[model samples]
Target: MRAAVVTVGDELLSGDTVDTNASWLCNRLDERGVSVERITTVPDRIADIARVINEYRAEYDAVLVTGGVGPTHDDMTMDGVATAFGREVVHSEAAEEWLVEHTDYAAADLTEGTTHLPAGARMLPNPEGVAPGAALDRVYVLPGVPGEMKAMFEEVAEEFEGDHTHVEVVRTAEPESALIDRIETVREEFDVTVGSYPGDDVRLKLTAGDPETAAAAAAWLRERVDPA
Candidate 1:
């Protein structure tokens, strides 16, 4: 399965907050055999959010959206989502009950800001915070907070499973330049994807859909290079 990530926040674009959510979600999706093909960062604007979601949802198997869904004014993700699918924003009774049962907030104090969601969206209960996430039309909206995002994602993690990839890593003392020819040879010879990173020690990573193919490629490269 393929997925796209949309991280919404002005803070991310301003570099005030690192977009750890995108990377974290990508890694988790990778482990679940879901390849994340695109990642986008947009300001907390409903139009921008709606545009990307509309585009990505059409192209990928899933679109994972993070951030800007809280009770704050800048939290416009839910509104953007409703606009994307032409759904009306309505109060989610399940979300309100969750707050009353799981949090200290009383029903009388709860406002539409806290309980409203896109009509027909499935509520993904938050295990760590007040605002619950939502799932609608293959668009999974998650919290911007890392802990809450991670916890909420786990609740629906199984839905993203696909063909798993096996990876093998090899470290070499040789420079990347010295290994270029060998890297090309192995890449051409095996059905594996190779990545070479140059650092104190050159690191070669091989990934393939089959475990034996990945292992064989790694072993073949190991025989030709000096191990670090």
Candidate 2:
């Protein structure tokens, strides 16, 4: 399956917070055989969040949203998600109960905003934090905090399964100039992708729909180039 990831937080846009959530989600999604087609970071604004969600949901099988899911004012992801589907933002008593039961917070400590969600959205329980994840149709809303996001995603990871892509890596001391012809030959001979990265040691990555294809492509290149 193909998916898109939208990370919401003004702090991410301002460079105050690094967007590790998107990378982590991408990796996790890939491991589950879901190819992430896009990664977008939006400020904590309802309009921007809704726009990206609306655009991405139409194109990908699923849209995974993270961040801006707290009780605070900047936490506008829920509202944005609601707006994207033209759904009403309703108070979820079930979510409130889940929050109360799962967390140390009392009902008195919570606000209507804390438990509010898009109407018909399914709650994804959070074992690590207060704000629970929500799933409405193809959109899955998750918390921005790394731990909370990871925990919440694990609960829904199975929904995104597809054919897995296998990767093979080759670390070589040969420069790009030395490997260009062989790389091109491998690309033409195999149904795989080859990426060359220049570093202290050149890194060659071969990826394909199956392990055998990737291994064959890597072997083709390794026959001509010396491994580091």
Candidate 3:
């Protein structure tokens, strides 16, 4: 399946916080044979979050969102997701029970916003933190904190399944200018994407339909361009 990632945080946009969630989620999805189509970082604004979620949900098979699940004022991801899906936000009893049983804090410690989830959404357990995540349709709303996001993702990893192709990189002495025509030819011949990066050295990346296709492309590239 192809997935889109949304990282919601003003800190991420301002460079105050690194977007580790996107990278980690992408890697995890890749291991499960899922492709990440796009990743976006946005502020805590509800309208922007809802717009992006709606747009990507219509385009991709799945959309994974991170951030804005905390108790603080800026935590608006859950509400935004509910708005995007045209659903109301409600407190999840299962999530409340999980928090009461697992965490050191009492139920009263959880802010009203922390327990609210999109209506009909499934709760994804977050052992690393108190706030639980929600899954509605193809959208998975996760906690912004790296620790909680990783834990929640691991708990629900088995629920997702998809197909993915492998990519192999080929570096050669030939400049990208010399290999542009050949790269285009290979792309047209095979069901794959060929990307060329030129800098101090030239690097060609072949993303093929499968492992065998990647091998064949690598061989073809090697035959045409000598490696440095």
Off by over 4 Å in 2: none
lDDT by residue (22-104, candidate 1, tens digit) is 99999999999998999999999999999999999999999999999778889999999999999988889999988899988
- Number of the top lDDT candidate: 1
lDDT for model 2, on a 0 to 1 scale?
0.90
What TM-score, computed on C-alpha atoms, does each candidate reach?
Answer: 0.96, 0.95, 0.89
Writing each residue's lDDT as its tens digit, candidate 2 over 1-228 gives 999999999899899999999999999888988889899999889999999999998999999999999778889999999999999888888888997887888988886588888999998888888888899999999999999999998888888897888999988998877888888888899998888899998999898998899998888777878879
TM-score of candidate 3 relative to the true fold: 0.89
lDDT of each: 0.94, 0.90, 0.87
Error of 1 at 215 (Å): 1.2
Considering TM-score, which of the candidate structures 2 and 3 is the better prediction for this target?
2
Which model scores highest in TM-score?
1
RMSD of 1: 1.2
Worst 10 residues of 3 by lDDT: 184-193
Alpha-carbon shift of residue 26 in model 1 (angstroms): 0.7
**lDDT, candidate 2, residue 193?**
84
